[model samples]
Target: MFSLLSSTFGISRPLILKPQTWRIFSSTHVNHALPMDPERRKKLDERNERRRFRIAHDPEYQAKQDEDKKQRRLRYASDPQYREKLLEFGHIWNTRKSQDPEYVEACNASIRARQRSFDKLRVRLQAENPRYRLRKSLHQWCLKHDWVRETLPWKTHQPVLFASKVHKECKGCTRVKVREGVKLWWRKIGDRDESWLCHACHMPMDNHTAAMPYGYEDVTTMEGIINRKQELERTAKG
Candidate 1:
């Protein structure tokens, strides 16, 4: 009868016979099954809450937000019309993306292409105007003058000849002449009979007093007069 009972509960016989077996089993499983202490859990929750509060209230985060706001304000202030249009387009795009992304992209592309065409036309018009070229040349000249003042001088003044109708005058007789184009001349400066004749007028005057300075032969051109005036203005400024 004992053998039959032992066979029926073979593996669990020692556990039922020994009272200390329950204590050993309980000790091994207690650590795995027990819940965390309430106070420690509460302290951890408080710490996490404090961390989140600190992050939300940090001055650096606030400063970053303020800087972003300021940049947005400046951008909008500088280009209110563009900003308004962009914002309106953004809203439309967001609202319609699911329904009409392709249409929105096509509309934006067409507007950009039209704007580029208008810009190109404006550039071409400015380029065709000679006055615009002159102004640009004058501006570049001024910029170069600003770089090296000791060696290079700025020419800010317009020539009196440009304003006056007459560009040529006889130094000897004080006779002014208004000609359609540039005129050269030889003039006797004083009673000593010191005379200098420009190449253009010297061709007609056989008795022209003296041959001009070496490069003066080439100085009879319109470009020469402009260059001479520019040089004089630069010298005066320096």
Candidate 2:
């Protein structure tokens, strides 16, 4: 084996194994290691890039699009099973797509394009959505909400979603259980009850700008944190 390698490289096996020797001659010897035509590679890369650009820009191919549409229309119009299959496929596709950034950005852009002028009445009408009422920062919402105070007390360590017949599991991220020690959010001596969040989600929540209303300067530091806690306690008492 050693003699064959030495004969092939015209160098000692030790020299061939040496990293420095490989680095020194890598530019010349790399083709032997991974032989491929540079021009061919360049052409392939260009072709792939063009394909990606076309896919991103064009929703459907111009040549086959009409025929494809015709087939789909005929299938839907003629076959109930085809229509049902399409509906099921679309539901699943949209379910996945809702989480996609590109889809979300496109939806946002389309909504903004058709956005009506925000009058007071329009604002009030939009605000009628129950979601807006619960849009407060986690801390503020947890602190003020009676639902958390009385029902879901801060001292409760294992904060879990109610397991009814339909839902037999926690609604948290279904990722692998990396650690047994999930971040059990509690109302600390100076805090209100926050929901039990996984370590990954909890970290981002704590560090995020949206989490802190007045800014981290008020509650980030030890001294500031203490002051804020005392203020919260006072408010609770008052």
Candidate 3:
């Protein structure tokens, strides 16, 4: 009888015999009803974390994903029969799964984990990548300058149009044509603002006039980026 009971629930024979153990293992307990294997669950969580991280951070992956979603949305909007079928399937699946408290708990846990992972990754990237920080600054500057719209169907200008508007009379020298306008310098604080400045003052051809002691260089390229990152790190130490 002991062996039979032990084999039935995979618990030790002694535990099965104990009244206290039985109470602890009662069906009323949510955890006792369904328990995930620790090792398997960890592997699944790691896999999901990696997938979510890539989707949230990778630009190439995001572009492909955006295109796929755009196509799916177009199809869903155009094909009534297909859309209906999808709606029916989604409704049924949601209705069935909504009744499962375990499934709901698992989904909530996964969402929370994904969000935590995303936040950490974003913070790390912001700390490590100068390019990302530069872009974010530009985005904020654009918003501040009213160069872009607030809501969807944004009035953001194309590169050429944006350049035209951004390149007008230098904020420093007030010379629009006689002097070449320079955009934000990745390395200099004065040049990083939204307003344009004359190249002579903000971005010198020889880098002698640059506020920062370092010479002006394009850090946008991969090799240049690594070199620039090291330079910044070295500068920070001093």
TM-score of each: 0.25, 0.26, 0.28
- The models' CA-based lDDT, in order, is 0.40, 0.40, 0.44
Give residue 21's lDDT in candidate 3 (0 to 100). Answer: 27
Model 2 spans > 4 angstroms off:
1-35, 56-175, 178-218, 230-238
Question: What is the alpha-carbon lDDT for the whole of candidate 1?
Answer: 0.40
Residue pairs with colliding backbones in model 2 are none
Q: Could you give the candidate ranking by lDDT, starting with the highest?
A: 3, 2, 1
Tens digits of per-residue lDDT, candidate 3, 1-238, equal 2223222332211211323223322211122112245664455446556756887899898787678777877886799986766545444444554467875676567558778999999899877865554455434433344322221112112111234423455444656452443343222233344443343334333432222223323333334534665677788798
- Clashing residue pairs, candidate 3? none
Give me the overall lDDT of model 2.
0.40
Q: Go through the candidates in order and give the clash count of each.
A: 0, 0, 0
lDDT (Cα, tens digit) per residue for candidate 2, span 115-201: 654465578875674333223334343344444333422321322322221212223455455233332232223326443443234
Best candidate (score: lDDT):
3
Q: Order of all candidates by TM-score, from best down to worst?
A: 3, 2, 1
Judge candidate 3 against the unseen true structure and give its global Cα lDDT, from 0 to 1: 0.44
Specify the poorest-scoring 10-residue window by lDDT in model 1.
Answer: 25-34
Clashes of 2: 0
Question: Model 1: residues >4 Å from true position, as ranges?
Answer: 1-94, 97-99, 146-238
